[model samples]
Target: MNWEQALGSKAELINTALDLLLPRASAYPSPIHEAMRYSTLAGGKRLRGAFVIAVADILGTDGERVLPAAAALEMIHTYSLIHDDLPAMDDDDYRRGKPTCHKVYGEAVAILAGDALLTLAFCTLSRLQEKGFEPGVVLRVIQEVGKAAGSQGLIGGQAVDLDSEGVKVSKETLEYIHNHKTGALFSASVRCGALLSGAGDEELQALSEYAKGFGLAFQITDDLLDLTGDQELLGKKPGSDLAKNKATFPGILGIGEAIKLAEDQVKKCQLSIARFGPRADFLRGAANYLLTRKR
Candidate 1:
């Protein structure tokens, strides 16, 4: 199957896995449960979880074994988005074409929702460890994800991004911001997947490079979208990044150059996995999809 078809197929499996892992309808207090489900059930590409499952599949691991880790990845990703949209961060009013959690549920509830999601992610992972994973494997996954989600990775990148607001920054600084803020999680997604499936050192290193290149490409495309995308296509304000004077890839590299850069990055990402055979098709498909995504 082609990239589009492959991604569609993988998405189905990922969604099914998520359904198996999500909290039941009765797991939370009334309105809070509604709010939690509202954000969790809201449509997303489910890319991180898919990455985990795909990599596990590539390494000949069972899908069921990877489900808990995949669910944890999604919870962490959702929590990040929730916090990212808060007033102190991006302050976005719309996400995935609907009112943001804070806008719909009020800030306090939104904060609580984000907190709950974050804790829930760890709880899910801990449960997996309790089931039967080797303590070493669980420790590695937790350390990798914690670093990715914490100050050294996404959070650090966000800090730099916020600090660079309304100011000129060098290209290196901009790249660092994009790499940490977004690339870290992307890298962790692949690493966590590979680790869960027992991939070796060399294969893990290769997938890490693939994830890094793809993550940067993803960010570059997002920057380009912010500059030239329509609000209708983007599902949110298109020019907010530019209006806020944030330094973006296009801001530093020019639109044409930025597109070229993303394409090059995608090519490198694909090259990193050419040896993995048919099992690596999903990774290649995801890279291609990232290049062509409208939102």
Candidate 2:
């Protein structure tokens, strides 16, 4: 599928949508706008947005109909990364190959930038209704996305991750951390696409399974990357995950075992989409890409 090329195209679509949804650069005469722009435009793979758009494509819907929600998901994801790299969290010095927001804009500004991006996410979604999508579907997307990004989902996972750092934890606890911290957003992205496309309950369930598997697989691959990826390749240091004492798949299982686990999850994700036939190709492709990702 030439995943590198495909991923580039997907990333372009996501960036375009984000540009369309961003508040006007001069909307508020504030420095926070620059900070927000710095963080948002620093650039990542935009995998979450790609997943949302791909799911919409699978449902035979146009990307335009789902672009706002997809961009919103990217904004939320970017906000999480911003907060996660704070001095209180990972204390990361660099992100996406550039100095972090706090490093460039100061801590207070960085925090406000994260807050602005987060609130902007909902604002983007709220505008979707004006784009002519079904009102009921838009409402459902908002609700699902809110819950996923809230205390019960990403935030909860982050809490668990913070508490578990440097503490011995069971495999189950590790699962909880990864599922909540990483899986919830994945679940939301897929669910949002399904809801937007009017997918039935059965299809939604299948997509949810696919997302869960992808979530875990994504984290596992990220851990693997931290172990083996070059700083230049990853836009961050290798072995940072272990150096930070972050809980990770490799921390729980040896690297060999972690790779096996990731492979298994990829299979599970592919199986989840089997019933959808050719329409599920992108989902399958995405799962495979996760397994093979170096950065």
Candidate 3:
């Protein structure tokens, strides 16, 4: 299958796994459970989760070996989105074309929902060993996910973002935010997939570089979309970064420069994965897709 079709297939698997894993809507403390599903199952591209499947494919790994990690990453991503839209964060009312979690479930439930999703992510990762994976591999995967989503990774990036907001953020500061906020999770996804497949050190290192380049390209285009994309196509308001006083690639470098940077990054990623030949074709295609995606 093409990368898009493979991504869609993996997304379906992730969504199904998420539904089965999460507490039912009728569970005690029903509101939070419902809100968790509402935010998570609602729908998105599932890029991070899809990476697990894609990387596994590249390494000829079994789906059973990597699906758990993929699903866990999606849960973590959803949790981040729920919290990132809260009053204390972006203060937005919309995500993926629906009301924000806080808007629909109220602040208290939204916060709790985010917390629940984050917890569930770790719980999901812990199940890998139960599926007969080597305990050591499972442990490493768990640690990787924890670090990726914790203070030193996504959360830390968010902290830098909040601090840099409304200030004259330097290029280095912007790079820090991009690497930590976006690159960390992307890199983690690749690592999890590679490790699950037992890829050698050289292959892992190459994929690591590919993931970083892809991540930088993704973020740069995200910033550019905020400036040039249609709100409807983007599933949110355009120019929001400017309105929020958040620094972006286009904000630091001109739009032309930003586009050049993104394209260059994509090229670097392609080069990094070139040794894998057709095995990484999907990854190369996926990286390029980021440049033209409307949402």
Candidate 4:
């Protein structure tokens, strides 16, 4: 299959796993569950989840063996989005072409929904043991995901991002925000699959480097899209970054320079896994796909 077709298949697999893992909307305390489903089931690229599956595939494991990890990563991603759209956060009204979780469910329910999803992500990770993975491997995956989502990773990056808004920050600071906020989970997603598939330390390290470059490139392209993309294509209004006075690649480095940097990162991402030869073609395609993505 081609890249888009492959990505779509992975997304479908993840969506199916998520549908099974999440509580039904009719379950007790339905509002929060409903809210969680509302944002998550609403469509997006599912890139992080796909990364988990793709890495597992490249490492000679059946992608289905890591479905729980893929689903858990997507859940964590959705939870982050829900929280990121809150009034005190980015204050976004729309995401994935629909009203954001907070707008649809009210702030209280939205907050609880994000919390529930985050908790459920760990719960999902723990189930890997039941799926015949080693307890130690499962535990490592859980810890990796927790650290990525916790104060030292996503949260820390967000704190710095919030603090840096509308300020003249150094490129070093901006890189820190992107690496931690966006790149940490990306790295973890890659690592989870590698850890599950019994990849060697060198292999894991190479994939981590690939993810770092891919994540930065993805963020740069996203920033560019926010500046120049159409709302219909983006699934949300453009220029939200500008409105928030957020630090962005284009903002710091000029549009042409930012594009060049994104291209450089994509090349680095490709080279990082070149040692794997054709086994890693999908990942190289995925990194290239970042540049051309409209949403």
Could you say which candidate leads in TM-score? 4
105-135 in candidate 3: lDDT tens per residue? 9999999999998988888898988777798
Write the candidate numbers in order of decreasing lDDT. Answer: 4, 3, 2, 1
Q: Is candidate 2 or candidate 3 better by lDDT?
A: 3
**Backbone Cα, N, C clashes tallied per candidate:** 0, 0, 0, 0
Cα lDDT tens digits, model 4, 131-239, are 7999999999999999999989999999999999899898899999999899989999999999999999999999999999988898889899999998998889999
Each model's lDDT comes to 0.84, 0.87, 0.89, 0.93
Model 4 TM-score is 0.99
TM-score of each: 0.94, 0.96, 0.98, 0.99
Candidate numbers sorted by TM-score from highest down: 4, 3, 2, 1
Candidate 2 stretches greater than 4 Å from native: 24-27
For every candidate, C-alpha RMSD to the true structure in Å: 1.8, 1.3, 1.0, 0.7
Query: Considering every candidate listed, which one attains the maximal lDDT?
Result: 4
Q: Give the distance in Å from residue 286's predicted Cα in candidate 2 to where it truly belongs.
A: 1.0
- Regions of model 4 farther than 4 Å from truth: none
Weakest 10 consecutive residues of candidate 1 by summed lDDT: 28-37
Q: What is the C-alpha RMSD, rounded to one decimal, of candidate 3?
A: 1.0
Better of 1 and 2 by TM-score: 2
* C-alpha lDDT of residue 129 in model 2: 87
Model 3 weakest lDDT span, ten residues long? 1-10
